[model samples]
Target: MADFLGTDANPSLDGILYPSVQGSEGKLNVVLFHKAARVQALDIPKGAEISADLYVETEDGLEIDYSVWEEVPPESPSATSNRDPLDAREPEDYNGRVPTLRLNISSLRVHRVNHIMFHTESHTVRRHRFEKRGAEF
Candidate 1:
């Protein structure tokens, strides 16, 4: 997936940074990414904690209101997986994978939204193969 802010044609005026989750029924879906070699794996441990603050930004690129955000953390096993199901590969069938942390926010009030900002923090263990790169190798 492209960087939420980087891909915007006119980031200043056009406020929607990421495509809103359709059929979400008033829920916000967030995917977290980490920079690593293609073959590397991510390992988040059980009971790991992830938190984020959501903000609604104004047209002038200033934060306006604090959006009420609640996170439904991914299942422990799903969170610890080496590969994210949403990750796309080069060959379409390649084993190449990227680790992603998914969070679902419920009960957010959005109005005249220009852009959304997320401040996130995670407490988890991330592991990768030393020699070859990923857990699979």
Candidate 2:
């Protein structure tokens, strides 16, 4: 069976990126629902937001550097102004590339079990599933 998450360093995420890892450093116990996927919400820094990246492992039994996540654009938007709970007006349109989390699995074993590590700009590793965002999936 295909591991819903990757094996060892070669993780295979469902493509649904969560805001942050669960029960980690500064993350809170909040739920983030985007599209149709529901994920545990991450309490990131004041200006930080959701982002995605592929985590890969090499044949040398070493995990790939997490810096590659920088290439992909975060699917979620950063906190913006207009925080009126009663307001219904739409905020500025967010048009950007879908964040792509790439992994380098050049020498990874076929059946090795791996886990993907989500992180913030401060480099906090998240431990949770990247479920569908919003609620549409």
Candidate 3:
């Protein structure tokens, strides 16, 4: 996914673009969706750790190093049930749940970001899934 500051075509995003967004004040925020297909293709097991590096390109052809924010998991059903009515929270879906692995670009100043790139890596550990009943085989 890519976000641009102005309404124009970004050559860097050609051929390998997901979606684009227009912003103001030369500030752009990008989000990479973690869809079900990607999850299955990568074979991302449950409780896996993933990380990524973020890079941005300015309108003036200047490459900048933007800060990468970690993924924030959505609130669980039990956690939401304990929330106070006055507390502010994001709207829930039909199943009262929110997905994860949505990236956000957090920059203090306007960099006129025109394109974004993410280099991601995942570290998964496999564990035995078996229960010993009354006696071992």
Candidate 4:
């Protein structure tokens, strides 16, 4: 649980890499990851039947178990009072909230921020290139 939004960090990127996320490869660097791709719809793009063996048998990456990029550490109350919630190994980012079921509401809502100027064409990208597949789930 310490990938810290590396999405299972250790595909190796101590710097920068923009590879074409082939398989079993992910990364992280905050920026709210678009509120975890609008609550795990991954911003809705893979509609070609999701059949990479049923997306690796029901893909449950949970965007690396709920990306919490609250400006790299933006929760207060002295960071939620130094938790002790029965001390069963604590590492929580309930940013993707359920909260004991108060109608199961998720959180994170940052509106209004659009200042852009983007261009990256290193031959159209390919950075942390990993191509060692065949786990087959």
Candidate 5:
């Protein structure tokens, strides 16, 4: 069972890495696709463009996951000069050794954000199935 959209504190994703964008305060939504998968597209920010289906490839030791996201203070020891600021194009992956997010001046801002809804294996369907992204499993 996935988190769907609610903020699930998945400890397994504590140390996984992800490209951190600058001032990207918008909450990230992970939409998983399966035969029983469903989609709920909500909250289209002003003048935001919908991008392609994001494919996060993971294999071997390092994998893609999410943790109970926390904001890192700028003066903290872990959030020191040792780390680099992240931009959209030149974003940085900070969840390497620990969960960290560093803010800095950049041309990027939080663009479009959508509340993703997911469906898991169940006897009956709950929501509208996202057929395009769905697959047999």
Candidate 6:
């Protein structure tokens, strides 16, 4: 299989770092990489949980493997909220308004913008493998 999303194209980015994550609970980037294949980078955030799927091509074009990572907070007292449970992030003041967690999938789709549905897990990190197919089975 020829992996695309996780492969690092830039030398500056270097090798895949274990844990493959950065920043704190409120804000962070999930990074995946492979040294070969000259593929573009795939950097994702919590919002990617719903927006897209990450895939790697196989020797047979008929098949492709995919994975997804969802963002979740640890059991932190500070993370508890008083507002609506559906609210994705903590409220904050900005321009006399509050800020929220708007779903963003920019870095994850730098290579292309094809509609995809990645996998998910109860924990923050999730990885899966699937064959690209004709039907949603």
lDDT of 5: 0.38
Q: Write the per-residue lDDT of candidate 4 for residues 3-56, one digit (tens) a residue.
A: 454254556322333534323337434232222333422322222223222122
What are the per-residue Cα lDDT tens digits for candidate 5 across 1-75? Answer: 344322344433222223434334464444332322323334343344444322345665454332222333345
Every candidate's lDDT: 0.48, 0.43, 0.44, 0.38, 0.38, 0.43
Query: How many pairs collide in each candidate, listed in order?
Result: 1, 25, 0, 1, 0, 2
> What is candidate 2's TM-score against the reference?
0.19
Which sections of candidate 2 miss by over 4 Å? 1-36, 49-82, 89-137
Runs in model 5 deviating more than 4 A are 1-14, 17-101, 123-137
Which structure among the candidates has the greatest lDDT? 1
**lDDT tens readout by residue for model 1, 3-42:** 5442443532222334554534466554433232243433
Candidate 6 global Cα RMSD: 24.8
Candidate 4's TM-score:
0.14
TM-score of 6: 0.19
Model 3: per-residue Cα lDDT over 14-82, one tens digit each: 222323334434555553323211211233333445675455677876565655344545545554345
Q: What would the per-residue lDDT of candidate 6 be over residues 1-137, giving only the tens digit for each residue?
A: 12433343443442343331233336544343333224333443323443335556667654444445466535456654467756565455213222222335444333545765545456577789998889768
Error of 6 at 65 (Å): 5.3
> What lDDT tens digits, residue by residue, belong to model 2 across residues 81-125?
447766664656332334333334454344445775656577678
Q: Report the CA-based lDDT of candidate 2 relative to the real structure.
A: 0.43
Task: Give me candidate 1's TM-score against the actual structure.
Answer: 0.15
Question: Which window of 10 residues has the lowest lDDT sum in candidate 2?
Answer: 31-40
